[model samples]
Target: MTFAPLDPVRLTADLIRCPSVTPAEGGALVLLQSVLKGAGFDCQRVDRNGIPNLFARWGEKGAAKTFGFNGHTDVVPVGDAAAWTHDPFGAEIVDGWLWGRGATDMKSGVAAFVAAAVDFVTQTPPDGAVILTITGDEEGAGRDGTRAILDWMEAQGEAMSVCLVGEPTCPDTLGDMMKIGRRGSMTGYFTAEGVQGHSAYPHRAKNPLHALVALLDRLTEWPLDGGTAHFDASTLQITTIDCGNPANNVIPARASATVNIRFNDAHTGNSLSDWLATHAEAVETETGVKIGLRCEISGESFVTPPGDFVALVADAVQAETGRRPDLSTSGGTSDARFVKNHCPVVEFGLVGRTMHQVDERVELAQIAALKAVYGRILARYFA
Candidate 1:
């Protein structure tokens, strides 16, 4: 018996119309769950803290070798709706392109892989398993999204041998680049306290702004490292520094600054936190200002070395698109940072030139091509 082929573009259009903005179900998962369940996949809602997520599996609970695909349904808000060429949730097709807020950022990716998975199993069922982890919290605070599903999977003794994150990794073309890893991300909040007094009487006042600047200068000027083999050199950027002093004649009692870091695997969050503390203490001692430091590490760097699995994905991409994708570790954080703990993970999808832009969109033909790439990967992985 022949099974019906899935249309990813239609699924993408349906998803775009749901308005599944972050922290809202918006019927995106409901549509996906219904489709997966109907196709014989076991579907589960692993929501946590009011955030919605879905887990679908097409084979046994703990298959020795399972393939997993992870993606997010939730999208960033459509800022300044009037600036959009098409309705942010309209999912309109114009000039061979699909226009919508999540068209490229990832509803299309989710749809493509979901379509590929369904068709692969029905047409030629793999000997192992196929799993899809779709989260609705990726565009917001990511605590309850993929993390919640993985927790549930662990409790249920479910696992995937290897996972692919369908994040938009290409920069220019459909098969230009694929991410084998990502840099870690962290932010540091620093506060400097000093006595408030007349600015003209400089000796009587300890200028917190001065201390803060010195500390920031020390951080930004010092290089974290030269660079890594698969990753780039770490960086620290001072996002904001505020003294709250309105009058030029007075020095404020406190000044605060926020510094963000995108580090390589050479440093852990704790190690970098200590580095910031050391500089803060030195500035405090040198300037006699009380300095406080706090750091938040969102994720740690990880890499899936060039090996058979990496070759499989690269070969599949090149075979379909005629572009041998560059294996890269460049990009901001993703849910793969969480999945890396469970299994070896890599990311590939369509060009992301418009992920969070005011007029986000995707090429109509690219959706079909992306599904083909995913389909080839499934065929080879299960073979």
Candidate 2:
């Protein structure tokens, strides 16, 4: 059967038409599997925790060098769809741009890579392997997507030498930036317990709210660090503080505050948790109240330092876009954090100015340009 080469813009439009919000397949993965299977790829659909994911590979077996493209079929929920000029899932192309949710924050990126893979296989199959890792749990809790697939790959003894995550990393142009690393994120919740009594009887009750205020002040007062060479300084921000009592005359029995930190390589979740515990103990001693703290880690910071894979992508961007891409580590967390454990991973994609916003969209030209870059990187890595 003769297959027409995939067009990046058309593929992008098709993907955006799916309302594959987080935790929803919306037939996005099925569409991708059909495209890859038609190109002679061995495809597998793996479902974890009801989240649909897929893995596809082509080229000769036992190929020494494997080039992999990583991305997600999931998109964040389109808040208040009525605010969009067109249907959020309409996939409308107006004035040379495709407008829709996930058009930039990543379904478009997935399309570009798929088109690149089609170009690669049709022009010249890789000497090694070309694989795609697509997951649906990226925009949600992330418990059962990329992490699960990585474990499965290990069990099957499948290894990738290098992986590129097609997250929307570009700030301005298609090839202006490439992500080498990402900062770690941890969240902390604290509860200060005290005796409740009439506010008029100041000495009769310990005011937990007072203790909470002092604790938050200290936590946000100091800088976590000056930051490292490739990362920004660690930051802590209190997201919420709650004391349900609305009575003006009653002292609250407890006060709770939640904070989130974005940290660099200088610290780990354990180290920060330890610091929080120490501070909680100090607050307990000073305020004479029991302070309880809980910590949750979203992801640890990671960097894929300058190396052969990084150079390969850089050269490809320069060749295709005539702009030497800037290697950066600035961005929120992505599935790349999970892939970093199996292989060196970096992120590059379309401009992200519209991600997670109303009327999300991507330029038509950028879709084709990004495909060319991915195709070049594949050729250079597997040559």
Q: Rate the local accuracy (lDDT) of all candidates.
A: 0.95, 0.89
TM-score of each: 0.99, 0.98
Global fold similarity of model 1 (TM-score) = 0.99
Best by TM-score: 1
In the range 97-213, model 1's lDDT, one tens digit per residue, is: 999989998999999999999999999999999999999999998999999999999999999999999999999999999999999999999999999999789899899999999
Q: Which stretches of candidate 1 lie over 4 Å from their true place?
A: none
Off by over 4 Å in 2: 1-3
C-alpha lDDT of residue 24 in model 2: 92
Deviation of model 1 at 77, angstroms: 0.8
| Shift of residue 181 alpha carbon in model 1, Å | 0.4
Clashing pairs in 2: none
RMSD of 2: 1.2
